[model samples]
Target chain A: MKITNTLLQMVKTVSITAITVLSFSAHAADDKVYRLKLAETWGPNTPILGDATKNMAKIANEMSNGRLQIRVDSANKHKAPLGIFDMVKSGQYDLGHSSSYYWKGKVPNTLYFSSMPFGMVTTEQYAWFYHGGGMELMQEVYAPHNLLSFPGGNSDIQMGGWFKKEINSIEDLQGLKMRIPGFAGEVLARVGAKPTNIAPGELYTSLERGTIDALEWVGPAFDLRMGFQKIAPYYYTAWHEPGSETQFLVNKRTWEKLPKDLQVILETSFRVAAFDMYTQALDANATSWSKMKAEYPDIKVRDFPPAVLAEMRKATDELLQEQASKDPQAQKIIESQAEYLKKSRAWTAISTKAYLDTQ
Target chain B: MKITNTLLQMVKTVSITAITVLSFSAHAADDKVYRLKLAETWGPNTPILGDATKNMAKIANEMSNGRLQIRVDSANKHKAPLGIFDMVKSGQYDLGHSSSYYWKGKVPNTLYFSSMPFGMVTTEQYAWFYHGGGMELMQEVYAPHNLLSFPGGNSDIQMGGWFKKEINSIEDLQGLKMRIPGFAGEVLARVGAKPTNIAPGELYTSLERGTIDALEWVGPAFDLRMGFQKIAPYYYTAWHEPGSETQFLVNKRTWEKLPKDLQVILETSFRVAAFDMYTQALDANATSWSKMKAEYPDIKVRDFPPAVLAEMRKATDELLQEQASKDPQAQKIIESQAEYLKKSRAWTAISTKAYLDTQ
Candidate 1:
């Protein structure tokens, strides 16, 4: 009876064309629910990285007033932690939450979107992405793949790693067995370090039982849980993947089907969620590092000596140059990043760097 | 006839109670539009700061599907640039965009929400606000005044100032007639510098004609337009207002009146807009500094000598101690910030600082 009466009132107001047009357009959209399924690379209940997807989904749902409902499927459910890009592109999922660099095997240009060894820091990279033609370049990369990409979240600066002993000079890194993966491993290999990839579950035991002398996991916020500091007392500072950014992917068909308002809501959600993750990582790292210091008084925070760092940086440049020479698109991105880094770093040196140094 | 048929169809499907309830609630919300008014301390089109409000309003409108409309009035329309706190409190405006320190005179504790002397940098402060109880302390200060406050935006790091001569020592600062304002000015005065506030319009002339020997304005992004570099050859690095954060002010009553969805939309818009402004500031500063350097190749980037910086830090500590002695609330906030700064900076030193220094 309530439904009937409401519809009857709508019929009575039909003589007012303005009201009728407004009612149909707005009501039709509001009444239909958009239920999207998102597949994430992380397992369910993972910390900061997992939190970003949930935060974004909740914000979008609330802002849309239930018009947009998103179901997040973690890797536990999807059973393909590294398959996010393919799943979203193939429409197996409407959206995916993962880091862009994971797809580098399939798309070499994808490597630039994530953090680079000795690249710009978080804020500098964000400035590049939003204002320095990064977003447009990113779209160009993804558009051909039936996908669209947005920055999902940042994990803040990833520390260089944990070492059982201090690294005093370039000689210390020679033939050092370390569990370091991805592009950074290649850089380490060039620097005479024996870089090896080990599964996350076996990392602690491998380091403890002498299978590996060192391992480079995430920073304190994540590393604390693995008890790496318990066995490895020397915690090195960040160099590789200084400001690693994760990405959100959407199937082009899914995005195109969304109403303009929902599209805006989804995009805004990704941005805020990405930013929030960064702060969360900062806070968590601080809290965790404080706790780690109290429990492990002998823990040494080390920086790779200048000579070793110089070698690593040189290798990173050579690797990037090789990629640039192979592809025009890669060259464009590499040059853009290099030019931007130069300008932004100059300002940062006189601003943030000076302030930190003063006090 | 179409509406009549729809009514008949609804009557036929009346047995489904769940569908009827969902439809009624969704349609009712869709039909209503909420209009809000905002007053900003900035003049119209005031670059990064002004862009925050427009971006926020646009995001909220689109995310809410045009159900929420915000009308923004700049200082010109309101004729009360400094009256945002009062206007929002009295319901003259539903929202406001201004810096928290502006209301320090009216509410002393409000000063802590904005940047502080020798305090946390941008991401550090954000970590404090969202995770380290900053929001709660901020709310406690505003609740009594019938207002709610959120971090509006960050202006990145503010450069110390532009100087006509080098500040070589603590002796160089004595009797220095400089245009620096707010708490920073107080710190300068303690060190025997004559710190005075000048109207923005007359600042370039004041400095050029030696009305003031050195003047601190915003960084290159803003100072370039005033051509400060053309006159002041020495551009000092930051010593004060390291990371200045602006704020979003909402009247408690207006906040309560908003629908749950609109409220979330408004808050999320503030967060995203606030973060975007920080990035925008970084980009603009980088671009502007590049331009300024190109035009004036001799612009010297100076840092206050260590002795001078040490004295300024001492002054800031003493002043803060005085505030804490007078009010327990002030004491609480000051201590919280101090403690958080310690923990966060410890992490930062090993993370961001380490990375920057090594590179």
Candidate 2:
């Protein structure tokens, strides 16, 4: 009887302990803090891109009521800008911001999320993503890599680049060394130009030091800021990238761990950021161009010669076809984008373009 | 002799011309065909406002390839809707559209604009305005004055109507006849119903049926649409009209004179109408209810339950003072609306209060 009583007492104690442990865990979970780390390829002050990150942070903080705090670190602070996707997917970082085109090697389909050479406008892209299932496809592309993506900001239409030598014809591109990226870079490479990939921060130095013969880094606003005019007198309006979209990518694991409320906040904030960034870029670009003309008279701004443009266009078509043939996902996105563009173009041609031409 | 010769020649020519003209010419401007008139209260659609009108004409002409041309008539249409605003402003039947809130005196802002007693949901309003802004703002206000206005469209964040109801305590509103438009009409009037101004088409029926207790029209949107709603719902929700904007107004004179561009082609092909009336309204309003329910379910979706919301907030104070002290332009609009409401409310609010509250 004594032995049985002792065994019973032990069991009772163990049961009580187990129950206490379970209750403690439940209580702790109620007050759990979710810390999210965000890595940005651009610096904190990089115009719309920077503003988007700040807005994202603000909304997340407000929505979470401080429960989920996101710490954003610049590119070099964590990893190289090009490596952001890999880092996030590998669990080295919880979140990341970068241009999807940068990872074209790893995910060819990502090019659609960014911009094709001479592709859709910002508004058209927004329509495609929000209404035309582009967003869903983008997620599908990122899913394989274990990343969830949201549009961060749009640079709108971009100028070609600052050229050390004027590109008068297709022949001028032969043997030229230009800092370009994604599909455009491939096209340029095929045309015999030595294509180089240079980060935005390092672009000015490379151009100034003659390491690169020419470089494409957004439009006059950012190009002017980087002092490209000082080194490259020939500024060519590439019109290669009509609209470039940057993205905010979160590690799937970290994203799933977030509370439902936090998720809403993040998505809403990013959407608002996208809207704000597009307008802000437009306003800034307008002012920047005026400033460039007034302040830097030596800088010559010219449109790409028709001959060169034609060649580039031809190359772009071929490159896209080749990419689509190899990657099914790329083909799917390209098809959808093409269809949307075709319809949108028909309407916009008469409405926006016609009016603009008349003006 | 030379001077006399010259003078004689001039006198002879003048006399002959005068006699010939007198015999051949005597006609009013209206007597001419191929005259196009466009009527809108403000300057021709600027970026945010008249973009539709501009695009409409452009698209129509392009589609028809210069075969059709439109001439817009700005402001002061024949006789405006809701007095001078709607009739001429609705741009004579060829094309007309604007926010429903403008005709609140007829239908009440709540019933016309998908209004909530406190605030309308953007999504629900979008759904309600399939024809876009709604037929109410136009039919009640403009149609009576020999005009027609379609439901153009709107963006987010609308102002609540202005009010004279001294809602010091929720109880003070027990029998109050308030000018509430859109969806708010059903909810508020249901609690303590009274008579509201219904649109010209629905007015006879609504009045006969005793649907609404009061009504409220738009501030800006109503101004653009016209102020019929104000006449019915005495108390207004000024907090709701912060960012509500709309388009669509035409003058009878201009409509009659419009060429193909301004007439059928431009009016029918208005790009903004195509975009905003359908796309913007649909997208914005689609997710509104879900978002509201998910975020603010407890946000009191009811009328100021007697004294529940009697506490005046900052927005109310500033809006009232601003309206009272108004700028010339703003004052003209405010005084007209305020005076009209004051007279209407004296009888509507008091007489209807007893019956409504008791019921």
Candidate 3:
């Protein structure tokens, strides 16, 4: 009886010790890890997009205390540049950074919000998104496709494009095959220009091989990088896309699965990234332009003729009106934007315009 | 002898067990709780500034995993609004949020960088600071005073002020007490207007009591909030300040003591806050103006007479030249800014201007 009692006590002691060890192990396991894959549209060397993505990933990782890690894969590494949207929406990738204009074929209305022909400036778009409910509207627009959207950055105003021939009037646009996208393409089509959508990687080759006659990428920073000066000498001012906003699209399922704090970290990080990218692009473009002008003097920078711009503006107004008539959501957004613009312009006319005129 | 050997082994075992337990206790003691104190100039009800401070603290706490926390104290909580700089620099608080123009008395050079009478827009200022090394130069200027600076928010453009009397010429400014700050104040003084610095919280009462003839506290947003229309009837447009940038100043010692990751988080968070606040001001101003016009139709909105604006412009040019001659650091920062502006303006003329005219 004594021996049995002693054996029973030993069993109880071992069981308690084992249970404590199991509890410790379970606590450690509760520290969850979420690994995210981010696909970027721009090349690895592009300062604004590349730096923003890298900074965002670093901040997310640090904020999560290493629990959430995002690995960015440049466009060519995972898929072609144009394939980013499909990959993220299909959940083949967790997130994607690309211009929303690139996916106009898949989501037509998305183009207006991304890069409207002469619509909004960087600050104005930021205002519309955050305060005017544009961000919520964008989410609603993208929700059908199983994606969550965030404005990653904005290239304020872009140069028109590099053309092999000078454009003197609306007639010059006939049979002109230009690489453009979104509503701008539709506007160009109205003037008899054939709009060809091509990825940045394929642009140089197409222009060089005569597959395309002209192309519009961004401003001097990106244009200089893509070596557009070599193939096309006449670089026209891109007044259509006043503020071309880039977007970051995350798979809805992946976004929903993230911890609440991680979601906040990601959103805030992207907001900062947008501001950083705008400033960087401005400075980098200035530097690149100086270099181009000094070393590549053969490249000519020109503004679009007034007559061509006048025709394009009329078409843009009609297009916007038509879009508003079709979708009440688009109508509501445009109406509110118009009201805000009217008030802002009144103030700007007296202050900003006055200053510019005097200078 | 065998018993002594066994006892010695048991003592060693007990010693190792005690040491292990004590080591863990020591580590637990080393875990610290750092409480950061923030001072802001806005009242608790101010939407963007007040809300941003609260949000920043919340984000910082969550990002630190609750190890680091921030406690924001609004204006008049512990000190007066204008006392922010001294309080922060003297270590009365770890952080401060206010317009740098408010501290022109101590740092005259800051006014040029913070907000000129008619300087860069919100986007242009962001570009200068982040990419054109304006931030680094600002840090250098503030280093001697034991502060680390970050751009906090922007009150994009400001109306001239609300006044009871009309001034048609430069001579009309003599003996008129106008509420203005920073370098603009100097220009006002040069033109014979009595420049008086008043806090936003005090502007209403001062205006009512006739302590000042005119006052400017941002645009329609904050002016409506303070009910300035009740005290001053004539709301004038085209004030000296076009875009007024606010700043976050941190105690140098406190900033240096922070972890590298926390530093990045703080800097990035402020940048986002600036973008957020600028838009919030825009949206809020629109709402506030409609309410003002409806509720108080007697309130008059008038433009700054061209005669007054012309004089102010001449004074501004003289002020710039004088400062450039006096301070080398100010000269260097201004030169870099001017050079960038020259190129940016040329680009904008061809692109942005062309688009706006056509649209």
Candidate 4:
């Protein structure tokens, strides 16, 4: 009886020990959470641009069951909206949301990732990013900087902007003062137009007071609230920044430290957030444009005259050629984009264009 | 001394029991796995369509870290390519990948979720699905049968078809023998073409042997290997199923049973898979089209004459109206689509259309 009692107690003790081991591992696995900090270029409560990060964070946290938590700090907190690239690279921020072209000053090759003067539209550019070797090229550019980059979101097709005067011919564009920026400004300068950059806060005042002859803002979704329609008489269609895609920047160390599942969750969240933002922008643009037209009946939507567009196109081509000559990498990216664009545009013309025209 | 030893033994026993209980809950939390079965309409080893299911399943699995596992069964295994709705609704499968229109015979309201004849293109339709009350409408239509529907991958813009001869006018469509299925076939029949459905296995032989004079197939990505270009001299642009969206059908019970984290993981996978498929389809179409043009230099690309297109459009409208008059739900959906299309298309015209035209 004594041996039997001892044997039962021993069995009970062993079972309890096994349960403790299993419980400890499970608890560690379930309760351990990785908290990350994200820096974004957009200010707090910025509409489409800011929404991408919030949506991404929400989805990521939900998908990871609170294991992957991200804290987003907007421009107000960071005080360096344009420093996302450096911050993410140096691991000061785990991730960043910004447009790639902003880094072009430091890295000239970063220019091609965002929309060019006349580049692929959103869908075509997305295809290029995923299937047309654009992502590989993007990695080639960012990897050396200790960062990994993903296509963040698209702002849709940006309008050429509002012009106070109707441009009828190539001569009409001569010495025209416009608030344009970046490489597009260079293209316009070559075409005998005075391209200038004004701060966003001053764009409306500049256009209204004739401090600038015209200013190009984002399309109707963004432009409507700016009240540009009440001032500028002509809203020209887009030519520059046709499909401006933003970027999600991650520090290489941050990404490497994540669990494989968290990595997938993070990436998929980014993808959906990007797509949702594009759709949101589309709906917003459609709704806002309709509202603008209804409220402001005199808003004139015009395409730049063909002669002026031709000159701008010529200048764009010359600028691209000059840039290509300067860097082998630039030459490669330009050639790839041109080839992909030609092929995709042909299909686009026949499919989307055909359907629209027939309707 | 004897009382002290008894007290120590009691304490050891209680501590061991407490540790065991804690371990049990932790193990339960960390080790519990939820496995789901998915049914797809496509056959085993099918091309792009099958790949979508695989991609979705893979992402879901990776994101869940094996906690949520999904097994995919293609048509070959399920033996019910057209019975996805029944299977998923009965909970025979937790999820399904199929086009919503396939269930139209059983539920007419389901047809509107897929692409409509002469309707919005991919991006426009996607905008409608997400922002234009399409998801709610889809849920209304599907919720009755214990199912939830999502905008699955798009087939991009399907070509009108390869033709044995050019369709120059309405007269040319009279008595034309073609193999086209679904609502588009009805539109063609109303316009005087004899539309017939052929088994997929026999499609190539039927087209080759003149059993069908012309046939509507998917775009170049899908049609390239069928060698249709070798046989058909005329390739016409699209007028039907402008952007054919597939669907992901989920059993309500299955969805409800999932943890919140797993639910988000599944939905996000569906979203990314859908987006990835579109990009892939675009890339494949562009590549295949370039190849087809290179190899089949003699193939002529044409659009049905304006008069003929107008007739087909009228037929589509009439058919839709007839369906709407028969059912209140149909009317509501049709009106929603029409209103959204009008608003969205106006923006599309000024933005995407104008840009394409100028280029």
Top of the candidates by DockQ = 1
The Cα local distance difference test for each model comes to: 0.90, 0.53, 0.74, 0.87
Using TM-score as the yardstick, the better of models 1 and 4 is: 1
**What is the alpha-carbon lDDT of model 3 when measured against the actual structure?**
0.74
Estimate the overall C-alpha local distance difference test score of candidate 2: 0.53
Number of the top-ranking candidate, with lDDT as the measure: 1
TM-score of model 4 relative to the true fold? 0.93
Error of model 1, residue B241, in angstroms: 0.5
Q: What does DockQ give for each predicted structure? A: 0.51, 0.01, 0.25, 0.41
Judge candidate 3 at residue A195 and give its lDDT.
Answer: 97
Better of 2 and 3 by lDDT: 3
Per-residue C-alpha lDDT of model 1 across residues B249-325, encoded as one tens digit per residue: 99999999888888999999999999999999999999999999999999999888988899999999999999999
- Model 4 bad stretches (over 4 Å): A1-30, B1-30
Question: Compared with the true structure, what per-residue lDDT tens digits does model 3 show for residues A1-359?
Answer: 11233333333343334444443233222135678999998777667878878878887776554556899999668757778989999998998888887776777667656766656666667777888778988888889999989998877678888999999888989989999876788899988999988966799999999999998888887778799899899988766777777888899999889766578778877787777777777777766777777779897767777888888878988888998999887787677667766655554554455455444
Error of 2 at A231 (Å): 3.6
Worst 10 residues of 1 chain B by lDDT: B8-17
Off by over 4 Å in 3: A1-31, A162-177, A198-214, A225-238, A289-310, A321-354, B1-32, B163-177, B197-214, B225-239, B289-311
Contacts from the true interface found in each model, as a fraction, amount to 0.74, 0.00, 0.34, 0.63
Q: In candidate 3 chain A, where is summed lDDT lowest over 10 consecutive residues? A: A1-10
In DockQ, how does model 2 score against the reference complex? 0.01
Across B152-252, the per-residue lDDT of candidate 3 in tens digits comes to 88776777778877766767789889888667787888888899888666888888889999877777777777888887888877546656778889999
